[model samples]
Target chain A: MDERSLPDANLPPFEGGRSLLLGGAAAGAAGLLLTLIGGFIAPKAALYSYLIAFDYWLGLSLGALALVMAHNVAGARWNVVIRRLGETIAAAVPLFIVLFVPLLLGARYVWIWIDPPQELAKETLRLLQYKKPYLNFNFFLARAVIYFVVWSALALLLRAWSVRQDESGEALLTRRQRKLSAPGLVLLILTATFASFDWLMSLQPAWFSTIFGLYVFTGGFVGSLALLCLIVTGLRSGDSALGKIISADHQHNLGKLLLAFVCFWAYMAFSQYMLIWAGNLPDEVTWIVARSRGVWRPVGILILLGHFLVPFFLLLSRDLKRSRQGLAAVAAWMLVIHYIDLYWIVMPASSLDGLGLHWTHLTAFIGVGGASVAAAVFLLRGVRPLPVRDPYLEDSLRYVQP
Target chain B: MKRYVLGEFGEPEDCVEALRKLHEAGVQGLDAYSPYPLHGSDEALELPRSKVPLVALTGGVFGALGGYVMQAWMNGVDFAINVGNRPPHGFWTNIPITFESGVLLSVLSIFFSAIFYFFALPRPYHPVFESEQFRTASLDAFWVSIETEEEEPVADLEEKLRSTGARRVHTVVESA
Candidate 1:
């Protein structure tokens, strides 16, 4: 509430800290341009990659929300410094609301299961029918509403508790938060897992991952922590209190969480893919076959190296964990790879045509992801950027693993 | 009321002031409390060691055995079904649930063992609750005590308590 790297309430709003605004604008322009370019020439591969881009962006937003919930549940005090950074991403939930318009508009092209009941393969149809109670257009729309409701509810509640603590230094609120966290964790897992089933898992219709929900969860957590480290560092440079408020120990701790998520994301992704490949069932392997080949294979290799190996090695040094610059470099790398990983997951589905560039996808990317932030920024305006009042803040501030 | 007041230490060459005093005075069976967990509280107090971890480990093993038995009994005998060529106990499939059950059991047993280990059954040694010294532990204070249940009367313990640098010595009486 008092000290910030950007603008504080007493000070005017941080005018130029809106790369997101420009980013959103750029995405809109790109999407519109691609929409026009692809209008006359509908290339299959390009269409597929464009669709995958949607998953990539949405994954970023959803993953951010999941991380916020996990931190709240685990009572991780050191993470309090980056709680708002996570919140900014969670607050972008509304952008997704706008983003989904294109997906909903283009559902048939994206989801084969959305095609008529008689036309789909028998197993696919059976699965589709079984899931119809949940996967039909009406239910899908309803579920989308529900998903956002749960997500936005968590974002609002956690952010509210944090900012409230800024005003009142009562330690009891921290205790109250611990009590609330267990249930919040449950709600987060339930919503995130099933929402995966609704959104991406339904793409193939037949494929399932008991841990697929966790895959999304892990990606979100890693991506947010990277975004978090970068944002917090940016905030800390000039903000005097922030410099003191966040310490080497906190950085080390957050870096460790980042490392853990990076590993978990690798583990879950590998295990899920391995299990499906090992089973070699047509239903399961169908999902992996595309990514394991050609242009997608290089991206796959890049993901293995960039997402897991690079971070794993770079973060190995103890000094890197504690240093701001070292950790920020790793984060920037993580965000870029995360985009690729998201791209890898969705592009394979639309392989019939070449991975053509669409102005709409780029437009939708900004329109969807951009508008999400603009809405969040407007709502988050005047809101306290730090949870100054958390009882655990002091505990977290002085915390060193004893 | 017998009270113990702990005071400043002697030189680095000297033994722990409180323990040296208590041993010299033959103060048998006193309880100690501190604001924070002191490094050598047990050794200074000369209390018998706790075997709670051993009890906890035994309880954990028992819990894991129970989880396995319960699953085997349920899947193998109770309501078994053959799925493909897989065995009824396909414990791999049951790994997640079994592990969860075992963990749940271990935690529960630890809770119960702690109650048994810390407090004896009949609860005969109840001390009167009112004491400023006890409250000081919540803030900034450290003290130790020997019970008044020996050949030595409560008066002897009280006298030794003051020389040990105790801020105050209070005799906690039995309930009337």
Candidate 2:
């Protein structure tokens, strides 16, 4: 076979083309407007919804950063073609610093421990008092800033090195990336774990699970992979140049990773549930009881079937992973279910009454998710879709699944 | 009425090219053997995607349902013995076992389906082994074999294989 006949192996650099920039601006504007409207209609619900949306999008960006760092550390070849997408998504960590402001502003409404009701039992008050040092507004805000700063600095450093590698093609940069990623991954995991504890897990104040961070991390990683697949598939269809560079082999590898994370997320969720159920601690069980009862039970079931099983079965096939349309469908499904997973975690904490969807939920999701995606796409538009000058470019282009 | 032509190539790519050309030339019953799987060789052969995944899916579904039902029957109906004061048939408690069973059966199904259905395991011997050069197929050399009716001339086939970079071509007759 003639290798030269194949499309140019390098992706042309994209510089935020006029139409894409306009589209991103439009989406971001629409999302912001919807969120503002939601806040006006239902302040508390909007705050809660914003927290959920913030957690979801932030998880995605952080997860993408972790994946890219891990890939660099491992010197993984399969993800090289898709690595730029991960980097671009990770670059939005800085945007998250700004995005988290609404959550901080509304913290008093969303966090029960921030300001306890006077009628609360003495025991509950004491418990909130005990957690105060870690959960205080100032401390929480400071930690949020630290997490974002650490994450954004690392994201920027890694991305800058990658872009430099694109121009310089220096093999030494790969080594530097690998070396940096070693500590970068550790920092990411530590910060992400504590951040998860501080942000989402503290919503109920009394409820604590050691595995909660892992659960949240897994969900984020899974969502990031799904987003990557969706974007790559969309690019394949929309951009002929990129379509030629990224082949089915890359998609198949991505689908496999997505499936792996799906299983991981399920494992983490089940582990948390089972350990809590077995321990039967009052504080621990309260969280599960809140979600496992009333209308929340069905929602839990949906997460099981929709989030795990449905995608599990659909992605099991080799053909589906290899087919662009099939992989995209599964990616889309996973993305939706990932939001549901986050909603399941965040919403129940706010509305203990039962499973209910407020109009604010939709608005906040659209607002936050749309804007996050827009920002990431805008970042992506500024660079080549693939690292064209990487020493591994040919290796990535010729990658064949074993 | 049975005859075979075997060609050996120094490279996997050459073997794949020969197989593809032969396939495109309307040659019947073509197969390639290599020390390692060659990229795109499967596509050139036009082989159907394996059904092992479907088999595994069916097994997983059955296993999950079976595990769930067994637990539900034994605890909820058969004995009604409750542990931990919780409902015996609660899906939450059963999930761990259900997941284990599903994974176990899916893996087992893939193993059995691939070995028995796809590779046709347990065979003691095959005519492919009759050619001594065929052993190299599992080593460094790549080989392409074609079966044809005895009445058809294989000289043209040998010439075609040579054109595709086959180093050596040989004709073998098999007893019916």
Best by TM-score: 2
* Model 2 CAPRI quality: acceptable
* Model 1 regions more than 4 Å off: A1-51, A116-131, A168-179, A237-244, A354-369, A372-380, A400-402, B1-176
List model 2 lDDT by residue over A52-103, tens digit each.
8888888889989999999998888867777888998898888878888777
Q: Where does candidate 2 stray beyond 4 Å?
A: A1-6, A26-30, A33-42, A351-363, B1-3, B69-82, B130-132, B148-156, B173-176
DockQ, all candidates in order: 0.03, 0.31
Instruction: State, as a TM-score between 0 and 1, how close model 1 is to the true structure.
Output: 0.63
Give per-residue CA lDDT, model 1, range B34-152, as digits (tens).
55555445665566656664565566667777778888889889989887655777654554455567667777767776666566545654463455446665466555656654434
User: How do the candidates score on chain B by TM-score?
Assistant: 0.74, 0.92
How much lDDT does each candidate structure score? 0.64, 0.83
**Alpha carbon RMSD to native, model 2:** 2.9
TM-score of each: 0.63, 0.91
In order, the candidates keep a fraction of the true contacts of 0.00, 0.20
Candidate 1 CAPRI classification by DockQ: incorrect
Best-matching candidate per DockQ: 2
* Number of residue pairs clashing in candidate 2, backbone atoms closer than 3 angstroms, sequence gap of 3 or more or interchain: 0
